[model samples]
Target: MESEQALESEAEQGERLGWWHHSHPTFAGITGFFAGMLFVTALPGAFAGLLRLLLDYETAEKLFPFVLLALALPIAMLVKRKTRRFAQFMFVGMVVTALVVLGVASLVLYFMVDA
Candidate 1:
């Protein structure tokens, strides 16, 4: 009986530490939103690279954002741990900035290549 109680307590402790806990109320929302934004922003570059390597546009498009999301999720989690509530705003800002920079760079690169 004691061992069972101990095990249950340990499980609760683990739950408290997880991102979904009340203490980290914003963690999931922020992480998910940022991860999505990051994935979408990087999708074009990832797709292009994958397409170049595999010459399979369909596969590349499908896998590109999954890979990007995998990469972005950890980063967002790290930020959430470090900065808590501010992490959400920071993540959103960072994603927007990245998208803007990527968009501008791609346009420039396209023009340069065309010229």
Candidate 2:
């Protein structure tokens, strides 16, 4: 009787803590958003750095267009029903981040040129 009671209590505790093991509902969206931001910012810089390390400037510049192939992964994710929601959030993040960066950059350039 004592052993059975202890086992039941453990099972109840496990059930209570099970949600801790699983991600929250927003986890996917938040993760996808940050991932998209990083993909836009860091991925290109890292890719360029790697290319420069391995090849000359002329060769790396010629090969840089190949980076567009990375778009296929997100396109594939968007096509799949299971990943569509995360992919959508990722796209939103990418577009917003890009717009903000470009807007600030252009504003700064305009001010500098005007001055």
TM per candidate comes to: 0.41, 0.81
Backbone clashes in model 2:
0
| Candidate with best TM-score | 2
What lDDT tens digits, residue by residue, belong to model 1 across residues 1-115?
Answer: 9999999999998887773645666665676566556555675666678676986777766665555455555466556565444446546656786788899999999999999
lDDT of 2 by residue, 18-98 (tens): 764355688668878988898799888888999999999999999988888888888899999988878988888889889
Instruction: Please give me the total number of clashing residue pairs in predicted model 1.
Output: 0
| True-structure lDDT of candidate 2 | 0.87
Q: By summed lDDT, which 10 consecutive residues of candidate 2 come out lowest?
A: 19-28
